[model samples]
Target: MTDASVLEPNAGVTLVPTPNEDDLPRRFSDFATFNEALDYAAQGKRGMNFHDPRGTLKRVYPYSELRDDALDMARRLVAHGIQKGDRVALIAETGPEFAALFCGCVYAGAWPVPLPLPTSFGGKEAYIDQLAVQLASSDPKVLFYPAEIAEMTKAAADRQGCEGITWEDFATGAAPDCALPEAQPDDICYLQYSSGSTRFPHGVAVTHASLLNNLAGHSEGMKIQQSDRCISWLPWYHDMGLVGCFLSLIANQISVDYLKTEDFARRPLAWLDLISRNPGTSCSYSPTFGYDICARRISSQSNVAERFDLSRWRIAGNGADMIRPDVMQGFVNAFAPAGFKASAFLPSYGLAEATLAVTIMPPGEGIRVELVEEERLSGTPRDLSRPARYRAIVNCGKAVKDMAIEIRGESGHVLPDHHIGKVWCKGPSVMVGYFRDPEATEACMQDGWLDTGDMGYLVDGYLFIVGRAKDMIIINGKNHWPQDIEWAVEQLPGFNHGDIAAFSVETETGEESVAVLVHCRVSDPVERQKLHDTIRDKVRSILGHSAIVELVPPRTLPRTSSGKLSRAKAKKQYLSGEIEPIKLAA
Candidate 1:
């Protein structure tokens, strides 16, 4: 490993090393509750910055202001006929408006819900359908959208039989001086919707204290500094964007350069340029596909090598999907000549149920992966010593302070090191429960541990994920799995299964089926057509749905380290035009 000092120049920030893994102090002994921790930051003398490209920068809104704005928003909703605990959906990019609205819900004693920008749908109608489903399930009293989205939001509001309010309209109301309502550490703060990658999303009710505690734990675990800045392109609805990017910055009294999710997709290098131009210790995160896109889309004329200095970037965290080891390396290698440091690649683990972060690899560690036999990792047991092909899977590092992680067997018995099982977590940061789904919630939480539904093992206190338990597709009851389907198609003539992934989806008619999305990896028209049909036929023979194969390019398929396909990431690419779509064999 290189010296932390040596990496500082390339990072463009002063390197402050925390206590080593062996010497670090306890994480949460000082802050008992999330609100207590947030109060500590809110009560601080420092200010916050919500920077935007075209909008005004809110340099410093006192916590008192946040309190007042939240109360005002809450009152406005009530005046519009919303009631306490009524779902209030917010569909805006990350900014003072969204944050204030979320806070307003807290003050109004209503449940605030942050909706992710519509990425799957083409026009306005698909977004309307999505919003309708969320409203039907959540049954929100009111819906709030940014002014730019007002036109489309109206359609959604009309469909849901709910009233819509633009950010401007909400702001016109007088600020409320309503007294701060009493809140329990356990009372719900907001409804965080699921990512909706595989199926219809659910709303997870996160409490004021749960969110705050997770943020506090993230602050300490991530070593977030008060003077730090964050340049983020993550959607506000995603946990990474909401908790990891937004609230973490607020809690640390740091400034954040907030870019719209669309803006980053269109111009990814802008994220790096903004950080370099600002010359602040800034950090941000994205899935493996995001990194691959920037590496592909950002032009060489951008002078990224000379103009951007990544050494100051202390934490280039990767999460929200599987972290790809090669993708991280490729990004570092591509940008290294431009002053980017290798250690900026921070691999992390989290979920919405945990209010975002569960574990974070420390800074300057770069990233590490473990390769164990797939056969040994199968149904029988996790025998690390078995000599199957050892594939490198990225580690999400150790648990934060007060967070305990256990690898448990099917019977809930704790598994030993090198043994894969369900990843269970218990900490102050874990969520209270799933909203309105007591049966589902109970199935996940046992005693204190939250069963993550992910399969992995611990090696030297570091966490390594193998796969998902529920995501497995059981065909013939023999577990017709994702990786196997991808492998089968990748080997077909003219097919690039390395860029091919398979995911199961249920049809509108109600039958469960599978879809295969294959990245073309070729520019020639002849090869592209052959590759598309070849892979599709291969999948059809192996599985049903005759394999809907979308032919994209070499780097199109989303994969994390250990080279496993990320279905959610791949699906997003399919919807975003980064990858081609597929049609089933007629």
Candidate 2:
């Protein structure tokens, strides 16, 4: 695989002609496999472009060149003794090498397991542990990483007792002349590890057919047009990034511009700049925090309309976490001057178990939400004398083609519309099962349906996700979502997204109590106590009860690989004394 660093100069060259006359017609639907989709896309002119931290175009990898390079890498992999059905684990970094290597694995009939790149918050040792754990879970024949992370990768591979080789070294060997093995639709395409929110990450076994079905659904649901292009900074290890942005673009032959995830975190406006600069309609997706960060970054002096032209922005997709209506509205309000429309907000509900998207908000529907009585959300009788509290539930739209969604009660019977219950779905795109973990697989799968472990309701066929069922706080026989408590504390000043985690902790009497962990930066003991009391009071106002508020240092809370706040891990760590709270009283 050619290093993107070598192709940096070609950023100025025009490799493929952008379609100007009309939207390109969909061409790959008839294909049976991902390789077939790539074959069709390679015959076209559209391709993916990579950008540096500063948002400068660094590499232009057209589909045609990508196919040639992938074929070469396929030969090299086979020559190096990577047999069919062998797992080839690759550290997912946004660049040409990973792109080529991933596609090459498909061509070689090998399953590619994408592992997360080391995050800045985790430090080196933590990253090694994470990598080693995932490596052991997948049990890949070999691990591949970029030259930059070779040392860390080697350390992890050695710990897992597996061979590790850099991409450059892996491609250095002689190529075999043998023909590549053909892939069947049911062949395992890759292993996707569910984000760190889970107590234990399970490798999801996704087949080629399942992947293609989801991609086709995404295209159909989005109403893909020739003028549509993608601009994203999402990490490729996660479903939204890998399946939604990277592979979906290839399968659909849509051009894309990528900014590194780290870079986007630093300069989020660069994402908007890419969208503004694109001549075609831009479609981008992000979790609620992404929108919140961008909104907070905007200032009075900044001219949004003059500097950015978001009028062409089409779908501003929201997923990968619980959709916050307030954050979505904040983004629209902040960017409205730049021609960003509220109708462009496309909220969807999905999980990696469903292969990325189970439902997509119908095009042009934007974000339609329903405010239900809080008691209805709790599944208990309402107190009419008390002031009615309302929870804003965003309509996540209908399930995609070939997918069926149901809201099931505790008794395993289907619940009626407007009643909150466990979300279940049956579809062709559903994962076959967890890789080599039938116990985990059987725990979630019942008959042909998957218990999504998420709580939600339906309204005239549209889905409204409430929260993760396991994360629900049960206090005194009533149900409360952790998000409701966390969001309440977030309203306080000096707090930011992901700074709060709410869960239930057991008391000495064996009753569950609401526990809130806050990431605080205040050093003064007086101010820290004030902050803690303020959070407690705010949560009490929302839940009508007191909560145990623990103020920890900043970044103390755990986050998933996809950057979602992990309340489950936070609770475990807090109970285990791993996260020590400040001794304000002392």
Candidate 3:
């Protein structure tokens, strides 16, 4: 009831990303013990509100109360045969139950693995298959799901011979719990599944210590205030949503208003509505698509300006995908009447392997963009200016404290700024490795730096993510593989020998992969129609998708300084809409 009881006991414990030995805070000596820092909120800390759109807002337990419940659940799970070091699969939509379940696993010393409860997976077959695969590979000792998904999950569990329990059944209204294991900070706290946009998804092992350190760094670097509130519609399955929105907000004892992913998709303005309804200094994050959705979807709707006030919005984070300058500008311009400022748009860069955040765009600054010659960009090492014809690219800002980033060439040598190569980072937040895949873990994590596979250069100490070296396509916060679409389109006669370039082009709806930028020499109109049909059918067949294919004359696709068809460059051209489907022979 008292404010003091709501604050965590370890509230002031700040972990140092880089220790000056003498200046190191004794309580924050070890990053691995960071979750223990949540003790700051152990007393009467603020509570988590699980938004029930159809029902009234219910206040769950304070940090202390939730910790007790988590301990109790850990006991129940152990009684049901869960052991220390065991993997526990949790498939629940984002809500209080998920937070509690994850905390329970952490207390029990079991690894919590959260998988996508993708609404897109109709019925139970696809999800069951995906879950089964994950469980079989992770070899989880127990699987937990909400009541709604329990039946289907149980069926999969039965087939896989794994133990399963629904949230309701697991609760059992049990008593004050059992003994907890002494969990080391370096111990695996949870497993995050790789987005699987490129290959079969693999689990990434994140340690409790790593998570705590990252949150501390993020809080300090981004200037997260205790009074701050967060409203998010990002999915819990992803790192940005889970780590950035849920964990960081709660650890900082901040109140959060979370909306379902579908809710925002259905009504983009709900984000604005939530901001208006909750009058506080709140900050939230989303991909570029989210902003575009707000601009396109909300602009057309009525009473938007009348319903929301954007003056209190301090930081509107845009990351996890390409940062579109036009989309950010459009949102600010359209919402200016509602008091939205251009400086509120905070573009950042991060990935799952890094435990979510890497850089937070400087607060209260306009999004930065650079225009350079497309031809000289690949080879020339200078920031030479070119004609204004070049497109605007956003700067994702600098790395957080204790995190060191480098742009390295193919030889692993760090390249000078403007010399694009793989973006690599070394920091306390980097995950231990991919779960069970030593080879992949080795391939990506070299020395101390994790090769992000994204291409970008640092300008004046700020990081900018350009494209993925692995050829992964991100659309609406979802990762899709280019090879998958390429293979799909290769079924066509002209594409059989890898003659086609299938890549994604960003649009107002996020990024959609165009299956073929067919380089046919033909210029006849009737033949072009046939080419379009052939490419569309091939894409739909293999990827269950179709793109707005462009049939350009041969050699239209620009090569990199090293003679590679730069997908990033190709995407730039598609976005400009200059290249069109070439005519075919009649």
Candidate 4:
């Protein structure tokens, strides 16, 4: 990806903030189509604001201007022979051009497929491969991206036999007067390829009604106020960032401030600085790692109170991954002097199949947790002599407005409260199906409810997410969540978040055993061996068995687009010998 800061010349003028108040009354996304929602929001003064690495504002795109550009792009699409349902792939960069093109695809009635930009981890070839796979699945007629990545994006597009155009070049195309197709409520809105989409990808097909319903639920769930603005650094390719922060702000008529995801990687503190300067109450969302990174960046000597003011940060949402309570506590501790309150930490549960939100913690009802024995989580009978061990399961709040959630057992029976089961949800916002993947869609859908593929239980109406059902490591007839092993390893000194990957592997004798790959940073052989032994002993204490522990170089683990560790991919690469462990005899 090109350095946008270098490509786009910065005007040395003060960028005014988009309005926090709109003359048009606030509505919880009642429009039938996203086009209609944008039309309604265009009447408001609120809009999107883009910031630089140091939290300096560079562009302020008002809704009216955005609507104008979108209509022009819509005409251009029509002139370019893009049909009502054609897939238009876009490299989702956090800025105005991508935003306009996305809405433009909507106006022209094309299903806009938002693809991810190259993340900090994956290099050129890996990114090209990733894009090629997703492009094959979505089968878009054309792919659009920044000019900087033309070489790589064009390669991927050529591999998939699709036309690839830079947004800059596409803007210069003919915008002749062409009739735009009218979109209905049930028309397919977009194709969402989830964060982990690769190898066999499933494009979640969502309709306009489904999208609007979800936007409404999330807006009401967060209790959007007149003085609310969103600040985000999450990649727009991910559901939480695309729907929760970007689309939700537009649909709800709230202005937003954005830091490029890569920019945030270079300077995570910029996210907080933008939040601190928000004219109104800040309502931002991120995966747990976002908070963890920000917290870790601020040291004791940083003078938090003097450097920031977070008194009006109304809703600090946590989702898209497991909401680690310890990380949340660490953030609170790091920013408590800056007026950041614990009550602002809102834990929620959601996925791409649900549009975005399945459940959102009610206003001011902060992060809540319940501890249960490891045996209950694993669905194994308790042993007589072993002392009880527990994990803190977070309260993911109740279902968003008009959504119903259920925890079903292995037999597909709805389980009672406090009984662990597979999470299932049904609502108007549920996706239509996976695009061109009926078998995959049928496997997860029962009646109208979507099997969320997440393992969790309910206490009354609130959800307590455990982990992904597919990510659970089972051995000797007992279930073990990969997060348990990963989090336990993270507790060791010299280890941080995303420093370890754990999964079941076949031993030489053909027995399934737990294998952990640690991201070793130490260079000295003696210290490296000591660290490996300590981690091995730690895993032994947790699992009560000797597991395979190998010290790999730092950044060995792969992450999903949302930045969560891809344990399945790690296991695949490790088993395939693609990931060579360091030369440490164990």
Candidate 5:
């Protein structure tokens, strides 16, 4: 749509990041299709900046160059017999190639399926198994992955009976200039598999209209400013990363700097370093754990003010998992000396099924919490013998533009404010249904309202999430949220988030008991037993009964692609003996 030469960066120059302000006018995703949004973004001077593991700028990908690359890719896919509505699965690696390929499928009228890459704890076989399952579920005509994982990806592709090619090799294929298929507003733009889906995957089908609407919602919700630039280290495979950070930037004509998710894991301080280096106001989003890790890293570093300048961080958006107030507070306490403002912490709620964001905290409200009794959250009667315990439920803000939220009880009746129930949302941005899963689509939808499968209540229009509905553990007819159990263990010294997974398990007596699987780093037999006993006693204090505590190796617990702890998977693996527990002293 525009001259690529005008957007090209200076040759041999790798350190210059994209400009914070653009010459082109901001549109806020007013276009009908996502391709149109990219076309307009290509006309702007702002673009994407890629950084190395240490936060040094490596590649400068302007929108014009991305558009040209996508056009060439679209032509190549057409010449290769890819047609409208065909699924083209791409192993989502954060780079210009994947970006161009994802948009290229949009141009070609094919539904681009973004799949997760191999994570740190997930081994080769586990990664392959994950890939194969998603590949089979998406049923892509061809799967493209990075060259580094060609062997493993090929094995997965073979098992699914689909053609697999590395993106680098496929980039060299013949390209013939031809007219591309036209995409409409309602056309399926992409298929996204949520981070936690493992056994039975449902590819969340999002239309061009839905994606654009959600992007606009994010723009309005955040009150995006002309001087605002985004910095992110979130994975591209997750909704918050894929939609809010990447796609939202393009549609809104906002410049963004990115550090690979794995890189952030190795050097989290690099994320702060990039933010500190930003010349303009920065807007970034991450789950609570991301904030936790960064705060923990800076605790041992010297001179927080010298290492980071967070004053320019105008919007620190939190979502993609439960927003922990304690973690947020810890972040503020750690970075306040560095000019970090607690008011910049904007909490939100969303899921892939909603395309990206369903609710966003108002621009200056920051993180708000409401204390409710533990018995209220679990919907169980309190035992008068024990002192009352309260869990702080963080306010997840109000519904985004054109989105409606309602808390419904088990009887399918709408509940009043301050009443905990299943969270249901209705909006234009909500997906029509999961791809190729009509049964699931019907089960989760009621009269166009998508069941979010989360237990929460609305207070004066602000939604507060309790926990996942399916993640709740029922023991002896009482409900116990796994987060409450896991968080209790984390309160003990030396335990951190993701180190423990709690769930319900049946004992030899055929009665359900709480099982807490903790990641144990202690090797001494005495110390190991002591840690086990401590976690057991800690859990007992909450559950009011003895519970099962098993200490597994560090990183033994499984995490979803979005980095959330997967209690269901951990429970399944533990039951199957895949997760070996450390032997206790006789």
Candidate 6:
């Protein structure tokens, strides 16, 4: 294998070798703990590589160097008075430094909490508030971040009365030789804050056993092979990115490439560019919006096959939010000539609460959907007077080994197959509980099964997710999913994914009403009014009811750190008059 340090400039690094049977065997399922998995993986030549926004290789970090640096950092952390079980918050930047520090925390027996970087939608104050809230919740002993965000991190740390240091300083400090803390299977590995969609984010506590078990399941379910490589633009702060892309690859000894989340947002095609360059079978995961953005960006172009080769893209994994069949189909139709197959679309269901994955589609069983009556999905009685509308619900696949999934009604009784209800799961990968929030944890846990807070149903053991229980919008007596309404607005000309937020609001007369806040950019009064009327009429036509459509300026709608629209936050902001709509002439 060529040394990573000697790689030619702009010659994108390849971590996996040409398909060879003599390659070192996979070690993810062979280990009992994360550190053990790293120890074994370090003996191999594979590791992570990072790319610039333009898809050029910038850095190559081999597993051996990672292990060595992590061990040294672990000793330094121990010398710095960071003891076992103490929480250490680190801003999850996609690079070699953060990777080393994260694993170093594991070696030192300090639980590392990965915090998100400021997103494009949220300004500095918003980021500070987000960081402060998470810090206050975890109450970490110290917070480490990249020097670029030192000011914001310090301000958040100051508000929470915790020490804040830059990653460079933290790694450079010398300490007396000391033994690293021993990590056990049951030891807390880290705290993952469920996406920012929540009004108050709860840090999900996952143990070493839970994390490893989930990683093992990922390997077994995907039927990982020697030639498989992963390319991801998912943010490291998110569970799918952190566990599935970063940790899972490390544990399984798979070569992986990364593009910063911000960079990918600007140049979505850079993802495909990197994938086309991979010499071996490629695996990647993204939310539905990611695929939508790519397809839309390349929709008008021709000769796609000449520029890209996606035939080897084995697993185009989808998760982190609702899986849209239309969006997935759009992607496949646009790229089929480029060798991308619809079967490569691997839709799975999971959350941070379950470590990462609850269920995964069997290999090659891609994008299965069942057209069920809308009433069956809403858990509402059918309206005999109206024509039945069928919604295409994507099959998220069967539960991973050792994990059990159940759909339960409101009364907590397990519902029979084909009945839509709260999605629940029991498995070794289930989180212990929310950190420092027993009441919140108790509300979701029932007799060892976790209420996923997602509405879905089972068909012959396959999980089919519909929508979030809390985000469900009820109008009169009918159930409405926010995605259905959001998608309707997106179909309008000039609108894009995440440009609209939908939720339910209580009227003055104590009746529930559908409310929509659309991000509008047009300045003309006539055009703005036309846009509003078009959206309102479209939503009304879809649901057979009127909606209060408020047109706000572009970027007015708030987004979670992971880039998903936060309906709860949007509603709060709207109610507080923070998101003012554009005024029209009388």
Identify the candidate with maximal lDDT.
5
User: Better model by lDDT, 1 or 2?
Assistant: 2
Clashes of each: 17, 2, 20, 0, 0, 0
- The sequence of per-residue lDDT tens digits that candidate 2 reaches over residues 1-586 is 4433322346456544343223345664546889998888887778888888878787787788788778877888898889999999999999888888899899999999999988733588878888888888889999999888888889999998889988877666666567999888999988898786243669999988999898988889999887888999999999999999998888888888999998999999999998998898989999999999999999978889898899999999999998888888889888999999999999998999999899999989999989988888787888676799887888998899799999999999999998889999999899999999899899999887999999999999999998888888888899988888888888888888899999999988887899999999999888888887888889888888887888998889988889988787788889999899988866
Task: Give Cα-based local distance difference scores for all models.
Answer: 0.67, 0.87, 0.68, 0.90, 0.90, 0.87
Provide the TM-score for each candidate, comma-separated.
Answer: 0.78, 0.96, 0.76, 0.97, 0.97, 0.95
Which stretches of model 1 miss by more than 4 angstroms? 1-68, 78-83, 197-200, 299-303, 378-388, 473-499, 504-515, 519-526, 532-586
Candidate 6 residues 458-551, lDDT tens each? 9898999988999988777688999889988998989888899999998888899999999988998998888888998999977888988999
Better of 4 and 5 by lDDT: 5
lDDT of 5 by residue, 1-586 (tens): 3223322334685467779987788998888999999999999888988888999887888898888889888988998899999999998898888998999999999999999988743799998899899998999999999898899999999999999988887787777889999899999999999998898999999999999999999999999999999999998888999999899999999999999998999999999999999989999999999999988887555789887899999999999888889999999999999999999999999999999899999988999999999889867899899999999899999999889999999999999999999999999999989999999999999898999999999999999999999989888778888888888899999988889998998899899988899998898999998888888889999888888999999888999988898889999999999999999999
Task: Write the residue-wise lDDT of candidate 1 on 69-93 in tens digits.
Answer: 5556666666666666778888846
Residue pairs in steric clash, candidate 6?
Answer: none
| Model 4 worst lDDT run, 10 consecutive residues | 1-10
Model 5 pairs in collision: none
Q: What order do candidates take by lDDT, descending?
A: 5, 4, 6, 2, 3, 1
The TM-score obtained by model 4 is 0.97
After superposition, candidate 4 runs with Cα above 4 Å error:
1-13
RMSD of each: 8.9, 2.0, 11.2, 2.5, 2.1, 2.9
Q: What TM-score would candidate 5 get against the native?
A: 0.97
